[model samples]
Target chain A: MLNYLWGAMIFIGILVAAFTGNMAEVTNGAVNSAKEAVTVCITMLGVMSMWTGIMKIGEEAGIIRSMSKGLRPLLKWLFPSVPEDHRAMDHIATNVIANFLGLGWAATPAGLMAMEELQSLNKHKERASNAMCMFMIFNMSSLQLVSINIIAYRTQYGSANPSEIIGPGIITTLVSTAAAIAFAKAAEAAS
Target chain B: MRAISVLSDLILPLVIVYILSCGYSKKINVYEVFIEGAKEGFKIVMDILPTLIGLMMAVGILRSGGTLELISRAVSPIVRRIGFPPEAVPISLMRLVSSSASTGILLDIFKNYGPDSFIGRFVSVMMSCTETVFYTMSVYFMSVKVTKTRYTLAGALAANVAGIAASLTLCQYLWG
Candidate 1:
């Protein structure tokens, strides 16, 4: 998906620039943007490191596990078919907790694990079961507690109040997630 | 806005303190553990660098060649009629495709309009609530080799639409 989009963007950009006689500007923009990408990463490196470091502290301190424990009831409701003792339940809880804490690196592995475990419980190998849809909907709905990266970007760009958006972000994400749960259940019921 | 800002400002500091205290209570070698995680974080940034560069270059080319403007202009009237800032049209669309690419568009937005601008805050909140729907669904569904993902896509898109609308409304009531 991204491959075609990336190719089209570059191709259309140069072609359009040629027609507009702005090839020189496009050339400079390409170079500068690449350089800027490095600068942006340097800024992100500090924040990402610190955030992950702190979250790691939380992880090792067992705070992350406790949070995942708190998420069990919700997970049970979301995946009613999955047995409570199933490995998939643990993976799903871990993934949801990782995502909530913005530990994306941690989430993907657990998410894949959860998917495989769910697959093992699948009756139809060719179709996504209801549990699978519910799980995917929740993940795609954005269950994050904070927008760390956006806050970092805002800080880098010199916002007077970098974290001001955090409250609104949390509220907005909660609303979307709630709507996601409702939609998932409605879809589940209709089918 | 004032109340929310103060409350929001409390979050990070409180979280940091909480984690440190938790680590201490657990008798963990907090410093060594933090360094270990920081190293992991460093690797993540390294992983993102190439993708970020590619996205930046692509978006930059699109922008500098005036193609973005052409599209933005074509959509602004319609967007304005819908009460969405025209500048956000591209960001929202790009977000559904690639996260890094969307970040590029967002940074462009922050540059053209100050990060403190309404459109800037709007997209920030919107991005916070939405994910790369097509990318996530495709990857996960493919993992199970399921060609027929019946209601997942619809449910996900429904969430995104609700997210966009919710963010837009919240931004208007709070900051617009």
Candidate 2:
């Protein structure tokens, strides 16, 4: 799937660029984006360090453990394959909390850490486990409690009520999350 | 608006303070432990860096080639048939790949139509609810070296469709 998507993007992109007479711009786009990728990594490095550091403190203090334990039942239901006390649960819980609060910077590192933990539990190391797919799907569904970035953008654009969409946003996100859970669970069952 | 924003600002500071103090009281070498955990950041970054570069470059090429505009033009009419505003088709599509690219389209909408308009509010709600499905999948999977992702993308697309459908219904019920 990724192989096809990647190929289509590059192949169709170049063809369209030629047809549109924007070949040079497309070349620059690819090169500049590669550079921008490194820039994004640098930013990720800073945020990941700070967030992981704080999360480590929470872990050692047993705050993280207790919080994840509190969420054990829900986590267990969402991730049936994972053992109850696995370390991935800790990172997954933190990721969910951070995302719910719209703390995307904190969520990414925890989410990636969760992925690494889930990978350790993967039977076929190259193939994603059901748990990993389920986890990633949940992340994609992205049940954020707040849409701060959208709110800020609305404010910037001089909307009369910048946060008016928050209610609708939450509602729509919940619907998506429900759909995601159904789809993931059904897929798990099918396979 | 004010209530939610205020709650959000307070939560972060409180969490940070609580975690640090708890670690301190627990007799943990808080600073050293933080340093140790922070070292994991470099490894994580290195693991996913190649995937990030490839994904971004593809998105960049796709965007620069005007493929999004073309697709949006083609998709707009069909989306309009479903009572979804045609103007939102671009941001909705771009949000699947590059968030920043979608933001550019979003700002264009806000500028042209005003954010208070029905289309503005509709797109806002949709953008708020949706995720960059491909980007999220790529970085997460790449970090773990997972080649065969199976149904994750399919599940995400299902969620995206559901999100858009819900956004349309909610916007209409509330403000349409």
Candidate 3:
């Protein structure tokens, strides 16, 4: 991690020198890029707020609870160590649900709380348990439903159809999540 | 030309050649295909609503609870010394909360200060490659009830370092 940090610093330093040599263009492009990013971010906030509202409605309508019910079986398979009545299951459901909708912002705390709960169950204090490994793997490669940020970026970059990455995003996530899961399970077996 | 461009961009010409060899029908409607593709995106958003909300509320609670400050303080000095700005600290913390939100905020940062600024480059690169690993792992682990691992923090932080490196190098090379 420290190595990467140093590399980034060195890289940025060179970029600074290069841009300074051509002050006119670099400054202009940087300004334009920043401007575009702000516009896109503003638009994204609107989208995020709208989704957040809709999700609230879903919760009020019992939609989320029902969805979690459906996910329970799969959760059981993935986390057999957890007792049937554990709160961790609920947290997992919520976490997966958030990822499914590309509402990653919403999922952070639930992820943490879930980890705390899971930690309570751990017998070992120094090493990560198998379940911990599995959980990390899944989270790392969690499938995204919206990929909204990328779309916004594409728009910022002047792509004709900024949302066009959705198909590829879905495909890539599916592949990555499956790979992450496979590796995690394999590790569990070896351990 | 439009149809050719869409088909060429999305699928390999060899596949098109195979379809043609197989006596496939004449030209397809590019607009229709595009719409169909976009509709799939809408469906995905619809399908994930509950999870998104629960996750958000949980994060909202954590934020309200002031956990981000604690996490930020621990990582601040290292990030700052690397030429990343102090303001970027919260955004990076938010990233552990959510990527889209983080990106949205990054845009705000970029607006206030150009992307070429020391901070802007670091944040942008951080945005490009890093996943919200800590938040995701925290939730997943908590849900399953298997805790007590230190490697997760290490691995995730390491990944962020790599992402920062990649972003900085690429942006400087391409935009700088």
Candidate 4:
């Protein structure tokens, strides 16, 4: 009852916004928001580019592969469905690493690429595979260790110690990932 | 000085160019496109300005009508019992509602109190970890046509619980 109620609340909220001449406003907001989003995207570009360059450097330096190799055991545990040597696992590893640094913008493309590779491995069309479910769960939980966007916002708003959130970010993500993984496995088991 | 001035002008708008390039190819003249896009952008701003005002008013009502205050008050005891300072309650609640806006508010708190301040650090941790569960669930479920699911609600709420707990623990230990 409560589930349906909350769903209705959201549906109705979007509906009401659409009906009450707020559609124009909503559309406008979406566009304006898009513009602002563009600005933000731009702002993040250099940051992402820097990180991507660094990641590339790391890759060339064999650091990323080593990190992925080291993370293999844990990644295998977290994603039991993916073959350890699968290309999807590598993309997932890169995606997870990028996300941990709070590089959401960077992580997104990597995540999509990971999903595409994962999909290639999927034989079922109607029902999601275990890998798909785990991917979605992990993406939603998004184990952010640095929370770069928040730090950027802090800097934008004149924060004196914008980088201070890193510790908490790391801790919270570790906890959230553990919980998410546990719940996801439980759901898989129940199903 | 001339080179410095030229370089400075180039620096700020770099973000502008990079953003436009993301959705489109590099071959296009980004500056011209951005300029052309600004009119539509301005129109969008004008259109949404009223709604933005309304949203702000709604937020203002929550703030001034004392509902927000009451919520913080109600949650304070529970949070305090877990070792978080009372100041974290409001910010945590707000973060659940909207991350971008909460980021602004969190920045203000960080600025005023210093990031190492107990409450500031707690809020920081909270900001880093949590998603806007209510908003995301609402949007995702609606889009996906999921009209029934008690477990989904429970699941989302559970994620929030884990987030908050981790936030408290980390802030108290490492940042404490």
Which candidate has the top score in TM-score?
Answer: 1
TM-score of each: 0.97, 0.68, 0.53, 0.57
Please list the residue runs of candidate 2 whose C-alpha ends up more than 4 Å from where it truly belongs after superposition. Answer: A1-67, B1-73
Candidate 2: residue A156 lDDT (0-100): 65
Kindly list the per-residue Cα lDDT of model 2 for residues B1-176, writing each as its tens digit: 45534543565467679889999999999999899868875666666678767876876787678775677677877877888776677678778987655655665567558899998998998987889998899999999899999999999999988999998987787778
lDDT score for residue A41 of model 2:
64
Task: List residue ranges in candidate 3 displaced over 4 A.
Answer: A1-11, A14-20, A23-30, B1-130, B134-176
Q: Please, what are the lDDT tens digits per residue for candidate 4 over residues B59-128?
A: 3333333434455677887876767676566567666666544543464455446665677667767777
The interface root mean square deviation of candidate 2 comes to 7.0
User: What is the Å distance of residue B49 in model 1 from its true position?
Assistant: 1.5
Query: What is the CAPRI rating of model 3's predicted complex?
Result: incorrect
lDDT of 3: 0.53
Would you list the clashing residue pairs of candidate 1? none
Q: Per-residue alpha-carbon lDDT of model 1 for B1-176, expressed as tens digits?
A: 77767778888999999999999999999999999999999999999999989998998998889888878888988988889887788889888878889999898777778789998899889999999998888888888798889999889888988999999998999987
Model 1 chain A is weakest, by summed lDDT over 10 consecutive residues, at A63-72
DockQ, model 3, C-alpha based: 0.06
lDDT tens digits, residue span A2-104, model 1: 8798999999999999998889899888998898888888888999899999999999999867888888888889899999889999999998888888989
